[model samples]
Target: MTAEKALLGCMMKENHLIGDTIIKAGHLADPRHQALFKQMRDRHQQGGTIDLVTLSTTVDLEPFGGISYLHDLQSFANVEKFAEYEELVLEKWKEREKRNILTVAKEEDWEIQKVIHALDQINEAKIDDHIAISTGLADLYEAPWQEENQIKGISTGMLRLDQMTNGFQDGELTVVAARPSMGKTDVMLHFAKQAGWNGDLPIIFSLEMPNKSLIQRLVASTGAINRLKLRNPYQHLTEAQKEQWPELIGRVSETNIQIFDGAGQTVAQMRAKVRKLMHEYPDKKPLVLIDYLTLIRPEHHYGGNAHMQVTEISKQLKGMAKEMNCPVLLLAQLNRAVEQRQNKRPMMSDIRESGSVEQDADVMIFLYRDAYYDQDADPKHLELIISKNRNGPIGTVFANYNQFTGGIRDAHD
Candidate 1:
C-alpha cells in the first residue's frame, strides 16, 4: 500500500467517514490552487467578498484538471464539505487553545443539548431562538460610553481636517472638491503624506496621473517643491531650488507611502484592487484617493443617467469606506457654474452635477486658487474652503502653495 494510505489507515477511526486521497499531484501544482489559497487568506483578513473575477488570475479550468477529474476529486480533496471542515478546524483550534475558558456559548449549547437528551425537555427551553440569544450576549461586553465615543473613525491626517472631522471616524465618508487646475489632488496628497507618518499608507487610485507622476508629486510635496517645478526644475528654478530636489526625494522615502497603478480602473475593478492592497497592508487602513469621483465606471447602467450614475458611484464608494473601515478621500470637480456665479468660490451646491456627492460625504472641502482667476496675484496662497463640515466647525484655512514643490504649508495666521 502507498505510504499515504498506510498513514490514513492508522489515523482513520471506525466511525469516521474517511474518503480515499485522490492526489491529483499535477493539478495541485496548477496556479489555481495557489491563487485560491492566497485569495482565501486575503478575504478572511479583510472582511469583504471576493467574486470569482475579482478573486484570482487563474480563469481557465483546463489547467486546473479535467471536468471528470474535478467532479470526483472535489469530493475526495474535502472541498465540498467546507462547513464541516470549518467546524473541524475550529475544534482543532479549541484543542490547542490553552487560554480558552469553555466559553459561555459553548456551555449554554451543551446545556441545551443535555436538556434535549430526552424528547420531553425539547419544548422546555426554546432552541429556535438560540442564535438570537447568543448574538444578543455581545451587549454584556459592550460599554455604552465607549461605544458612543468611538462613533466616527478619523483619518489620522491633519489636525485642521481632523478637528473638522474628529478625524474621519469609523463609518463616515469624506469628499474633497476643487476646480480644474485648483490643486485638489495636491491637497489629498498632503493628507496622504500625513497619514503615512501615522503608519497608515493610504492607497491612491489615480486614473488621471500615472504612478510615477504621483510618486514625483509625493516627492515634491514631501520636499515642499511644486510638482510642476520638479518636472522642469532646470527650466524654472535657481541653483538653490536645484540643490533641494535630492534632499526632498530622500525625505519622502522615509514615510510609509504606497500607491496603486490604477490607470483605467472601473468602480468594481477599483474595489477588487483596493481590497487586495488593504489585505496586503493590514496595518494601513488605506485612505483611498480617487483623483476625481466622476470618472468612475458604474457597476451597471442607470438608464443613461450621466449625473445620477456619478451620484450612485460616490454613494457606493462612501459606503465601501464605512464597511471596510477605511477613509475614502474622493476628489471632486467643481461645476463651471462656480465660474458663472458673482462669487467664484465653490459651495456645497457646486459639486458638479450630483447632489449625492455632497450628501454622501461626512466632510466636504474645496480648494480654490486666486491665480486661476487673476493674472497678477501670487499663486502661493491657496484657500482651503471647508464648504460643509457636517461633524465640526465650517470655515477656511489658508495654506502657502509652493509652486515648484506642489506642497502646501499653513500660511501666516
Candidate 2:
C-alpha cells in the first residue's frame, strides 16, 4: 500500500511520470487507489491535466478521502524515488497475482497444467526489457561473418530446401500444408529424422495417427524399409530383409524422438509436457512437431466457430515457440479450393481457417505431387514450394517422394 500510494503520488505530482511507468491500475491493492490511478493515467493519456483540481472535477473524489487524502498522498510524493516505488508496487502485485491464481485453481479444481500455465502468464507479464536499435544493428552486422558457411537453424535434411530456408529457425512457426496423401506427414517425419540424428530432440504430437503407425513410418524413412513388408513380414519379407530387421529397428530406436499419439490435445497440455522434457534434457534443443492443426482442442470452445478456434490455437503455438526458444513445425490440411484450381498447387489461402495461420507462420511450405492427380506423372517427383519465408527468399525445392516407403528426401540423394 505504501509503495502504491507513493508511486501514484509521484505520478500525480509530476504528470509526466504516469507515462514513464509501466504500472497499470490493477497493480494497486486498494480499490480507491486503483480508481484514482486509472483516472490520472486516463487523463494524462488524453493530454489533459492530472492535477488535483482537474481530477476533483472529472472524478468523484469523495470515496478517495475527498481532497484531504489527495494532500496526504502528495505529502509522500518524491519524484527522485519514482523508479524504486514503481518496482516495489510491481513486486507486490506479482505476489498478489500468484496467490490469487493458486486460490482460483484450488477452488475450481483446475488441472496442474492449467495452474502452471496461469502462473507462467503472470511471470511473462512481469518484466519488459527494451533494448536500443544500435545493439541489434551491431549483432546484425556480425551475423553474416559468424554464420557464413553454417546452417543458421535446425537442418530440415533436404539440401535444396535447407539452402533456401537455412532450416526451421528458433522462435519461429513453420507450417507444412498439403492435401491428403501429399506427404505432409512424411515431410514432417523427414525433418524429425534429421533433427534426431543431429543430436536434437524431436517431440512429435501425432494427433491423427497412433504411435505404432508413426514408428513404422519412421523405420521406413530411416532404414529404407518397404512399408508393406513391415505389415506382414512373414509373407512380404525375404530371408535377407528378415535378417536385417534388428539393425533397422535398432537404428531408429537410437534417435532421441518422443511421440505422443493422444487426441484432442490442448496447447497448454502440450506446453506442460514440453516443459517437462526441457527440464529432463537440458542439453538437447527440442523441435515441436504437431501432425496437424485443426485436430488440436482449443482451451475454450468458440461455439463451433472453427476460425476463431484455429486463430486462438495458432497464436498460442507461435507464442510457445518464442517462449521455449525453439522451432515449432506444424502440419495442416489444404481446403478443397486447391482441388478446384486448374494447377492444383496450394496457396496460402488454401489453408483451412487460414487467416490466423497465415499471419502467425514465419515460414510456410506447401507440398505438391503431380502424380497424385496425374497417373502419367513421375511418382517420385515432389515439389516443396516455399510460399513464405520471413527471414529469407521463397522458392521451390524438388525432392524424391517414395510412396511405397512413405519417405521424402533430397532429390540428389
Candidate 3:
C-alpha cells in the first residue's frame, strides 16, 4: 500500500514517467489507490490531461478523501525514485496473488478453473523485456536511413546471389530446389559456413543426412579435399591432402555452427527444439537450415497424403521463421519432371510434393549442373537459377561445383 501510494504520488508530480514503469492499476494492493491510479492512467492513455484537476473530474474523490488528500500524497513519494517504488508495488502484488493461490489450493474439492485462473494471473505479472514496437514507429521509419540498419539481410557469400536477393533477410523462408545430386545440400552448407564465419550462430536440421555425413561434407568443402578422402583419410589422402588435414580440422573446430540430425522429426518437434535454442541463446541470431522439406513430418497427420503434409509443414516452417525472427534456408528436391524435360532446368512448379513451398518462400533458388546430364559438358560451371525473388531481381548465377570436394563457389572465385 505504501509503495503504491508512493508510485501514484510520483506519477501525479511527473505524469510522463508513468510509461517507464510496468505497474498497472490492477497491481496496486489498496482498492482506493487502484481506483485513483486507474483513472489517472486512463486519462494518460487517452491523450488527455493527467493532473490532479483532470483526475478529480473523472474519479470521485469523496470517501477516499477530497482534493486535499491528493495534494498530501506527493509528500509520500519522489518522482526520481518511482522505479524503486514500482518494483516494490509489483512484488507486493505477486505476494498477494501467491497468498490467494495458496488459500484456494487448501480448499477441499477446489475448482480446477479457479486454480488455472490464479496461475494465469501469476504468469501475466511477468515483465516483458522485448522492445515495444507500438511506441517506436518514428525509429522504425528512420531505420533504413541509419547506417546500422542499412544492410539488414544476411550475406549468402555468393556475390550474385546476394545481389539477387539482398542475401537472406530475417523472418524469411528461402527454398533451394535441385534435382538428385545437383548439390542442394552443398549450396546450403556453403551458406551455413558463410554465416558461421561471420560470427553468427547457424543451425542445420539434417532430416535426410546424418551429422557425420554433413561433417564429412563440411570437411571436404572447407579443406578442398576429396569426399572419398574424408570418408577414409587413411587410404585415399595424398601427401599434400594429409598435410592439409591439420589446418582443415582447426578451421572446422573454430566455426560456430550447430547441427541437428533430426531424421523423421515433425515440424512441431522442430519448433519446440528451435524455441529452446532461442531461449538458450537470446542474444545470438540463428540461421535455420532444414536439409529437405519432404522428410519432415507434420505434428498432426493430415490423412495419408504426402503432398498435403508437406504443404502444412511448409506453411508452418515459414511461420516459425517469422516467429523466431530468423531466416530459414530450406533445401528441397525437384521432381522428375525436370529430368524428363529437354531443358532440364528446374522451375517453381518443380518443387516436389508441395507447391506451397515455392509460394511460402521469399526466395526460390534452383541448382542445375549441365555436367550432371552430359558427358562432355563443363563440370566446373554449375547454374543457380533464382526463379523467384520476392525482394530483388530474378536471374541465374553460375558457380564452379567441385564434385570431389562437394564445394561450390562463384565461378570467378
Candidate 4:
C-alpha cells in the first residue's frame, strides 16, 4: 500500500507521470487508489487537467477519507523514487496474482500443466511490449561477428547444414519431419550427440521410444557399433568388440544427454521439465528435442480435433522455445501424400496437420532417403531438404547415413 500510495501521489503531483507510468488500475490493491488511478488515466486520455481540484470534482473523495487522504498521499510522494515504487507495486500484484491462481487451481482440481501455464502467462506479461528501434540496432552493432567457419547457433554436427543454418538458433523452433524409416529419430539423436559433445545440454523427450533404447542407440552411434549387435551383445559381439565395450560405454556416458521417455507428454509438462533442467545447468546451453509430434498429448478440451490439437501444441512449443531461450527440435510425421508423389521428397504440405507447424517453425527440414523407396539407390545417402529456412537459403544437404547404427556424418562427396 505504501508503494501504491507513493506511485499514485507522484503521478498526481506530476500529471505527465501518469501518462508515462506502466502501472494499471488493476495493479493497485486499494479500492480508492484503483478508482483514483482510473480517473486520472481517463482524464489524461481526454486531455483534461489532473490536479487535486479537478479530481475532487470528478470523483467522490468522501468515501476515500475525503481531501485529507489526498493530502496525506502527497506527503508520501517522492518523484526521485517513483520507478522504485512502481516496481514494488508490480511485485506485490504478482504475488497476489500467484496466490489467487494457486487457490483457484486447487479448488478447480486443475491439471499441473494448467497451473504451470497460468504461472507462465503471468511471467510473460511482465516482458516489455515495445522498445525503440535503436535498441535493436545497438544490439546488432554490439554483437561480435562470427569467426570464419564458426557456427552461430547450436551445431547439428552436419557441416553443410551448419553452414546453411549457422546451426539451429536459440529461440527457434526447428521441425524435422519425415515418413517412417526416413530416420527421424536417428537424425534427432545425431543432433543430440552434437549438442552434448559441444558441452551444451541435450534434452530429449522421447514419446515414441524408451530411454533404454535411446541410450543403446546413442552408444551404438558413438561407438560405431552395429545397433543390431547391441540387441544381443553376447551372440553378436566379436572378441575385440567385447574388449572395447567398457570404454565405449564410458565414452558415451560422458555426454550430458538427459532423455525423458514418457509417452503422451503435454507441451506444458515438457516445458516444466526443460525449465527445471535449465535451472539445474545454468552454465550449459539447452537443446530441447521431442520425437514425433503426434504422440504429444494435447489439452483435454481439444477432444478429438487433431488439427486444433496440433495447432495448439505447435504454438506452445514455439512459445516455449522463445521463453526458455533454446532451440526446440520437434520431429513430426509426414502424411502419406509424399508416397503418392512421383518424387518422394517431402514438401511442407506433407506434414500431417501441418498448417500451424509450418507456420510456427523457424526451420522445416524434411528427411529423404531414396533407398527407402528404391532399393537400387545408394543406401548410405540421405538428403536433408531444408524446405523452410527463415533466416537463410533453402536447399538440400546430403549426409552419409548409417541405418545399422543410426549414425550420420558429412557426405563423402
| TM-score leader | 4
Top candidate when judged by lDDT against the true structure: 4
TM-scores across all candidates?
Answer: 0.62, 0.69, 0.66, 0.69
Q: Give lDDT tens digits, candidate 1, residues 1-413.
A: 12222222221221021212112111122345444434434443465443333332333446545344234333333323322333333333333331233354366555643432232221122212235666777865576556454454535345555555666655566787888888887787887777776677677888777778888888777765656665676796668877876776666775666666655456545655666566567666677778777777764454676675676687677766755667777888877789897779888888777647877887788888888899787878888888777768988877887756677766754
Instruction: Give candidate 4's TM-score.
Output: 0.69
CA RMSD of each candidate after superposition: 16.1, 14.2, 12.5, 12.2
lDDT of each: 0.60, 0.85, 0.79, 0.86
The candidate 1 region of ten consecutive residues with least summed lDDT is 13-22
Poorly placed runs, candidate 4 (over 4 Å): 1-128, 140-151
Q: What is the lDDT of residue 284 in candidate 3?
A: 72
Residue-level lDDT for 136 in candidate 2:
91
Sort order, lDDT high to low: 4, 2, 3, 1
**lDDT, candidate 2, at 146:** 80
Q: Give the number of colliding residue pairs in candidate 1.
A: 18
Report the error of model 4 at residue 50, Å: 36
Give lDDT tens digits, candidate 3, residues 100-124. Answer: 8878687655686566546545633
Candidate 1 error regions (>4 Å): 1-157, 226-229, 232-247, 376-378
- Per-residue lDDT value at 159 in model 3: 85
Model 3 misplaced stretches (Cα beyond 4 Å): 1-148
The order of the candidates by TM-score, greatest first, is: 4, 2, 3, 1
Error of 2 at 103 (Å): 20
Tens digits of lDDT, candidate 4, 300-364: 44448688678778988998888677899999998999988898889998889875898999999
